[model samples]
Target: MSSDIAQPTTATGHARQYGDRALQTLLSANRALLRAEQVNALYQEMCRIIVETGGYAMAWIGIARHDPGRSVDAVAHYGDRDGYLRDLRISWADVANGRGPTGTAIRTESVQINHDFECNPRMEPWRERARSHGYRSSLSIPLRDERAVFGALTLYAREPDAFDGAELELLNQLAEDLSHGVRHLRLRQEHAHNARLLRRSLFATIEALTVALEKKDPFTAGHQRRVSRLSARIARELGVSDFDIEGIRIAAQLHDVGMIQVPSELLVKTGPLTPDDYDLIRRHARAGFDILEPIDFPWPVAEMVHQHHERIDGGGYPRGLRGERILLGARIIAVADTAVAMNTAKPYRETPGPDATLQALRDGRGTAYDPAVVDACLHLLRDLREAA
Candidate 1:
């Protein structure tokens, strides 16, 4: 087997060389931590950095598991060109395999160094494997979590007495940084999982509210769903982002939720209503806002519901929010709501054909509706007609 028997003439010369490499390893590892997004990716990068930057023959990370056998599993490794770890097994228990640098460092929660693997009795179990891989020295540093040591970062060197003094100190710091980075990434992943769960629960609650409104008003049975579809299409046509379009669609679905507070008879009345009836009908926007304002939604859902009826020129609604004052989602919902209502058969008004609806949108494009949203809606309607 090939061996690294060459040595520096002076101890000071070896220290200087090792110090420079260790400093580089520490710097590169710190930078990796800043950009690391996944634990496995970080582990792999650390092993690679240890070998490439510190000039080690091989490097690996082992996670200590409290399984039935108290095993230490090699999670990530680099530079084992001959696959020296293919049959390697280790444990933290006081066994033959566990007596090595890796297991002993983790077991004692400290650094374990073997300056000359050939002369070390602990290396007896895997001496031939180490020699075959050209590993004459090794260092293992325990990686800790908040509770206790969770893993070990082990580095193998081609030359004996490769790690010492300043070099070992810097490598220990690198291990500590890696442990903290792993813990942080896991916590972030868990928080994101919780956020997804919370979003699902919130959507469930919104669906139930929509169902209640549908039960109360027959006119609104399928109106919200249609408006939501058209609003999403219009938003997409206008180059709105997918995430914003999702919020727009959800707001459209619940835009008329305030109608739940309106009298059922008023909704179904075929006869001309007095000014008082019309005024009460207009209050639904404010009522919907009040219903949703207290809930913490990730999107501006409540404001969109409140301002869906508001005109761009300050001519409509519970609040006369003019021009840019209206939320973009609210503006999109307005056009969608208008298009759906005009084409649908209403008890008090005749159903306007697609041609008439298109004219009305053209007539009010910039005055009552956002010009861009109206254009998108017209484009969608024309496509639907042509497809039909």
Candidate 2:
């Protein structure tokens, strides 16, 4: 028999050709779906394809909140940059549930189009925004997984009736592929967030242990708490993000963790320390770093502990690190530690008030600390004292 079989009759051959093309399109879309690891990039590519091939003027991806009843938020957009900027500010408040084309598509879990928004009752509320941006027609397709609607993809055009039957069919298929990709992306993000939460929880437990150790020494019972407050305040003044501030605060609480290894009598001694006792006391910073190094913290807690004793002029601590080599977090902790230690009543000395503490930091600025961090600390101390 010949390796090539005879061609089928006309009708059968046409059906077979159509089936082959559909399979090829699906395979191409599946390849694109694998790039969904970066959702923003995937959405941008989807919008580009729609606008270039399907004649859309603008494209947007709005993701539904986990609560099915709530309206969606626009997570990505691609189009005429100026036009999108003008009309993209519509919040959930402006999109009535099951009313506008986008909302209706999401609610019905299907693709929808408004060829003339001016006459479409469902799109009336959003017509003005679209009209102002020169949009005459639009298509809204719901993105879904097996369970239910995940969100909607909206395409806008300057000309009315821009999306004909062929364009609509292509967009519908694209929306289905995008839905699966988006669902996968969401699951990955959720997993990453949960892992971060677990790491933070373990870090918190370590901080609590340090706090417990501090409490054992009556003189420093609340020392860690005060230092943490001061460090967080300084971080805020420096415009650090909330995430970094949380890390800095937790690290501050455990900065003196190595002190636990020192004898209790040495920690509470009223008189000046002897050579041997002083050497033991100085070892706490490195000891603290060693203790924290084994734990998997969400941030660089071990490095922060190690550098907390370092100074700006290369005169401080076990390694004598200077300048920017030290982490900003450690520098901030150093300033807070110094201020709190000076202001609080130690076993050997009386406590200075906030004013004296601020003056002490100012005197040591640049030599003992980072000037910017010290200035921020001084400002924070003044504000906190006034508030108190």
Worst 10 residues of 1 by lDDT: 1-10
Per-model TM-score on C-alpha atoms = 0.89, 0.56
lDDT of 1: 0.87
lDDT of candidate 2 vs native? 0.75
Q: Model 2: residues >4 Å from true position, as ranges?
A: 1-172, 175-179, 383-388
Q: Report, for all candidates in order, the number of backbone clashes.
A: 0, 0
The 10 consecutive residues of candidate 2 with the worst lDDT sum are 1-10
Residues 1-388 of candidate 2: C-alpha lDDT, one tens digit per residue: 0101112222333444434433454455567788667777787777766665444588888877745356577777777676554433332333454466666677667677776666566666677877888897787888887788877888887766554444456567778888778778878988988988887787678668766677767888777778888899899999999999988988888888888888888889999768998789889899989999998776898889888999989998879999999999999999999888876778877877777777878888999899999999777666545312
Task: Give the runs in model 1 whose Cα sits over 4 Å from its true position.
Answer: 1-10, 268-277, 347-350, 384-388
Clashing residue pairs found in predicted model 1:
none
Q: Supply the TM-score for candidate 1.
A: 0.89
